[model samples]
Target: MILKYSNFEKSAFLTEKKFFLFYGPNFGKIESCITILKSKLNSLDRTLKFLNLFQDDFLRHSFTEIVNQNDQDDIFGNKTSLIFSLSDLRVSSEIIKLITSQDLNIQNIIFKTGPIQKGLKIRKFFEDSPDCLIVPCYEDSLLEKKEVIMRVFENENIEISLDHKNLLASLLSSERLNLLNELNKLIIYIKTTKKNISNALSILIDNNSHDLNNLVYLLASKKRNDFWNEFLKLQQTFSDEIKFINIFSKHLEKILFVKDKILLGLTPLNAMKSLRPPIFFKEEETFLSQIDLWNFQNLRKAIKELHLCQMSILNNEKSSKSRFLTLITKILDL
Candidate 1:
């Protein structure tokens, strides 16, 4: 039977079916489903021993060997979960032959593949079979991605604001493993530094060098000479100007947030200190200098213009660093 990715659950796998097919372009989620299925199966029957096979090695003889095999492999009567990954229709005839020949004794075989169009007989065969279930693993939705970010942060006791959480959800890799890898780096960085994920986040998202974060943090400083000196060193590292604008704009928003908060009964330092996923300890001096440099109103205006500049750069493909130069001149002059 066909199973939708959205509808898949532990209960769905709790069945008499012995064969399964998980196919999709989203390989990360395909692995995730496989992990879930194995965990559920293991809960019912412990110490599952997995046998890994490829499409090339799979044959009728291989199937026969699996069928004839006893539980001598492990003392726990290990359930065999044959994982045929990166599969295609070439192995379908063998599977069909085995199904037609007799009942499948090995109940944990799974086939994982890339996208299978409707014309593929293998997908159809699994769909039609009572003992087989085919599920499509697809990319995650925006809301789903956001939920992952929230869950990860909540688990770490690292609080993130709604705005940042949304931005991260938007910016992060859609693939489950890649997304988790990025989040893992962020977790480590946050724990070690006891600081914000902004720098690490910017680096990961843009594929930029870690030190470029220093340049971004420096942009908001009142010390123009220091910024210009460091700007030259890091200018070549600005591989993606759009990403730079994104990080820089976000930095400004951080200051703008503090500036806005200052309108209340809080001091600039207090407002900066209050930021969750706290500002980097080393960057605190520059962050405070930013608060003293620009008023809330101008900083807000500058941030908006920076975003507009980003759009202009995106639209005007011919534009160079000159545009950033012009924008920075205007901002520093402010």
Candidate 2:
């Protein structure tokens, strides 16, 4: 069975099925769904055990070992609920076979994955299976984003004006998790300081804005020392490496766009002017310097490196600061 985000709540309790596949690009929504499912399972049977197994761990260990471990019943003799965070869907055949085995001891198997392309065998298997459900999560629309912002603020008892709400919606990235984090930051600031939205924006939003832009500028201009300095400052200001990577990625995309324009016979100056959000007058010279330093090829390569750096950060959160800095240094060298 396939479910839409809106209908998930109505069907969330259909736990009779043994396999559930939550696959899509909207990681935030996927996580939210997982939380709801876990809550439901706990409510249904408090004694039910929960097992978290990543795809890598599953592949590294013998399949028999996983089955045996999960097969062990709780003190109440109830089977454990296995939550599989799948990085690759190619191993779906093995997973499907295990779940379908008549003697399997798992209460439920929840499989979470990134976007799965069409015609993939695993996707097809889930779609065709009577025992599995497939839920696809795409990016939220503008109305959905607004509703989230309003609901989050309302829950926090932080009353925001409609205009401010719209402004925040615009300022926030499309990624729901990032938007939620920013909203949490806003709520905390409001509760702690009793500050208005304007003050919150100044302190929370504008204060560190220049640091990321400056850091990207430094990287584009190949200012190794300055890049390191700004990177350190931004790290100190913002703790989330993923957020930093998102900002860096957006700036790289802008640079790529400008590079493309230049390639299409437009002067660098003309390309810069054509940017949607016009470059700040003060930063124009720096932007031009970066344009001179990086061509289209170099920008593409840098974007790829940034993506790898983001994955490294996500995979290893503890050492992300150092890992991200190293990647920035490498990009500067390139």
RMSD of each: 13.2, 9.1
Off by over 4 Å in 1: 59-78, 202-334
In TM-score terms, candidate 2 sits at 0.63
Q: Assess every candidate by TM-score.
A: 0.57, 0.63
Model 2, 173-223: lDDT tens digits are: 455676687788788877899788888877756656666667667777788
Model 1 vs. true fold: TM: 0.57
Per-residue lDDT of candidate 1, residues 1-334 (tens digit): 8888767774555456677888865677898778877777777777777777776665544655654463244565566767777556665676677765664567577778887878577778888988788887865656778888999999998888898887787666566666777778789988998778776666655654455576677677745787789877654333346666787888888888888788887988899998888998987887888777878778778888888778876665335446777888788778
Per-model lDDT: 0.73, 0.76
Error of 2 at 251 (Å): 14
Best by TM-score: 2
